[model samples]
Target: MSIRQLFRMGMVTVALLGALPAAATTQLRVDLSQLSRDSDAVIHGVVRRVESRWSGDGRRIVTDVEVEVKEPLKGQPGGTVLVTQPGGQVGDIGQVVHGLASFKTGEEVVIFLRKRGTQAFRLSGQAQGKYQVVREEAGKPAMAVPEPSEALLLDPVTRQPSTVVEKPRTLAELKAAIRAALTEPAP
Candidate 1:
């Protein structure tokens, strides 16, 4: 092949590699109990807005999600709360932090939140800390659905794959569980 042709092919390969989506380097495997223990606040709310922007340091992209609190299972986050998570698109550039929880406007969710400094809160265990609320049937109340990625997890101690079977529960039941967890002594 001509040198010019080889140079063009190399350029195309480099561009294609840059366009590929980022893959998760680490998988989070936290059960409900662990999520509760790690979180400072557990809240059931609807996402009111989502805003993406570059971090103050300009090192990474972050998304700020405003959640209108319907109930506070732990802590005292009244009214609206801002939850920040890593990963977002800014203009032509985009960054995807795999395993990070994402939120959409008007979406209902149950979130286990850990305080970041004094102002922001983040998911305790990435996707494992966020639960989508979905209706079971027409005219039925909504239930919290755990992340599908949690279906299979690697046990930290054993370093072996283990299936995590999550049972659907109503919002009230989930709140109760969080309350119970709050009363228990931390391990």
Candidate 2:
């Protein structure tokens, strides 16, 4: 082909390249099967220890949050969030909430947690994940739900997940919901 034609083709290619849209980013999709019936949502726990610099260059924030991951404190923390990934190895996790600072040594805390992928369902994402916190007038302080985005990760199949917490639910209201769930009758 002629030089002029070659030059024109190059310019057209450049123009097309410039018109391409930017690449899309993939958001972290946390496994939802990690949570439990109700208490396995998110809760706010105190920072137990901030190990921002894990096994290496300190790129990953490794903090330990105190919350209860096992039985009894299923939803909250009397436990800690450990570092999962670090040292550029993607060590399962990357940060932890070791409970420290502003959150006294033995202060109470709220957190959203679930079984660690490598542990016996021990809570991991103490502060690394979701869980909305609320104080009840009944003297029972705790959390109800996780961060809003978490609703999206609940059921991958359900394109439109619901986050409705029953605007005006009372103790009786909650009891009714629980009762209904229990009476689902093996469905």
Candidate 3:
């Protein structure tokens, strides 16, 4: 091939590579201690409402979740709080942001929040900070499980890639861990 033709082919290859979707989002793995220490507030709550709409700039869709606080583990977030996260379905259009927490109405959860504005909050460590509360059966104790994510997580201290297969903990155990973490010095 001529030099000019080779250059044009190279340009096309570069353009195509850039157009491909990202394989996975990457972030540091946040453990329970980090979640407790970094969060402005941590609360166990039930999702009262979930609404998705276009952002003020009209560039993206965001979901606002209203959580009724059942227990405040860290800060005084009051009876209810609004937590917003990027991506959601709005009308017939939708956006999905990988490694972000998703909330559903009436679902029970323990959320680690960071204050954004006067009254709004966001997840402390994105997907790592949200744990769903589940019960196997009626009268059984509930379990708290970290929300699953497709993101690649790196170790915070080592900065090396890490894989975490979290095991579900009882609600009591999770609460205890959070409380214990609260007492330890921040890293």
Candidate 4:
């Protein structure tokens, strides 16, 4: 092949590589008991607003989610909380961290959070900590649905493929499990 043709082919290959998405992140999938035990707060809330911006160092993007607290299941009294998470869009630029949790405005959720500062929190276990509240029909009981994570999940203790099954639970049932997990003696 001509040198010019080889150069053009190389340029096209580099462009395609740049456009490819990053590999999926790996995370340890924690059970509900572990999530309840490790979290500083468990909140049932509606996402009031979401904003993404560059981090303090201007090296990466972070998203701030303002949640209007509907109930405080395992923390102090109900109020607004700002949850900061990694990865988001800043203008025309964007980033997606595959294992991180995401939120939408006006969506109801039950989130497990670790206290970061005054009324500030972070997700307890990446996508495993956020649950979307959904109902099949009007007036029907709502179910807490765990985020459908794209990450390769491993068991925390064994470091092997996670055996934990994620399934939706009624909101009431989820709350009770959290409470029960909290009250159980630590192992």
Candidate 5:
């Protein structure tokens, strides 16, 4: 083949490869009430350590977050809990799953967890299941600020995908809401 023809073919191959899209993940739509009802455990804690490792199948990356539980709102939990989330940086390789909850060491948070089996647990609604603990102002007590994952949501009212931004709620207010939901009879 001519050099010019080879060059053109190479250019086309590169273009096609560039056009290929990355893997996509979809998070289910879940309201506050649904998150509260569906979760197996609701925990308030501070992240103590985060470790990234490969899944058992060695197909994907997963992060193990060790959190020091301050309180357990739903299920009985000990002082510390290990929460697993998809995607993390291990060595030089990192896999990022959009809409997955990410935790940082020393960060305080409230997480809605769903148990997988005998020991494993996952976030109930990805990012919607996790809330960061932040103070409204200096000297003020901290509140739970939900991490924004609007792009990965489906509005319950509209039954369509849309962005829903939630305002920060005080710890007391959040706990009260969860308690109220817990009191309601299950469907």
Candidate 6:
């Protein structure tokens, strides 16, 4: 009931709220091979091409996509890599699945990608740019936004991202949890 007590309580609330993202940081520890399936994820890359094709059911649909590597996708061309996925969506739900629309050739955009199997990556929507495509070095693809370097709850971890979630209160403890989340194997 005292003013000092209320102020302390408010500060604690704010601090906890800020930690929510980190504390809730969940990573899917799937086998990198899982990247080869129809699984979905957010992909960042440039749009290289588009195709209007038919699905196995022979339904008329557009499969628009191109190659997009992860930011600094490691010793690879940083341009559109031909790809495709379903389109049309509205929100966080879209992030949860495939993109909401098809991409266009030469459009610099970030996509939420899913692997169609152990073969290649698929598009989830006609994604938008998550980074500013600026070439960091000559003779190299443009630079994209640096990934957050965190974890996704859907990442299929074999173990939990954090083991100390008994609720860490210190920065050091939180960081340890994050490291564990990153290194721990996913189921």
For each candidate in turn, the TM-score is 0.79, 0.35, 0.86, 0.84, 0.80, 0.35
lDDT values, one for every candidate? 0.82, 0.38, 0.92, 0.90, 0.83, 0.42
* Tens-place lDDT digits, model 1, residues 1-113: 99999999999999999985444445546778778887888899999999999999999999999999998888888787889988899999889876677788999999999
Query: Which window of ten consecutive residues has the lowest lDDT sum in model 6?
Result: 163-172
Rank list by lDDT: 3, 4, 5, 1, 6, 2
In terms of lDDT, model 3 sits at: 0.92
Cα error of candidate 6 at position 133, Å: 4.2
Per-residue CA lDDT of model 5 for 83-139, tens digit only, reads 888889888999988887778899999999998776667888888899999866887
How many residue pairs clash in all the candidates, one count each?
Answer: 0, 38, 0, 0, 0, 32
Candidate 2 stretches greater than 4 Å from native: 1-34, 37-51, 56-59, 68-129, 136-145, 148-155, 158-187
Local error of candidate 1 at residue 11 (angstroms): 30
Best candidate, lDDT: 3
Q: What is the C-alpha lDDT profile of model 6 across 126-176, one tens digit per residue?
A: 232122344456665444431232333332445544332122123233233
What is the RMSD, in Å, between candidate 4 and the native fold over all Cα? 6.2
Off by over 4 Å in 6: 1-44, 68-82, 87-99, 123-187
lDDT of 2 by residue, 70-180 (tens): 322333333445423222213465433231112223333333345555432323332223333455666664533433332122223453333332232333333344445
What is candidate 6's CA lDDT for residue 92?
A: 25
Tens-place lDDT per residue, model 4, 13-125, is 99999985444787888899999999999999999999999999999999999999999998883688899988999999998888888899999999999988776799998
Residue pair clashes in candidate 5: none
lDDT by residue for model 3 (1-187), tens: 9999999999999999998545468888988888899999999999999999999999999999999999999999999999999999988999999999888899999999999999999998898889999988998899999998878788878877775656789999999999999998876
Steric clash count of candidate 3:
0
Comparing candidate 4 with candidate 5, which one achieves the higher lDDT? Answer: 4
Q: Model 2 misses residue 168 by how many Å?
A: 10
Worst 10 residues of 3 by lDDT: 159-168
Error of 3 at 73 (Å): 0.5
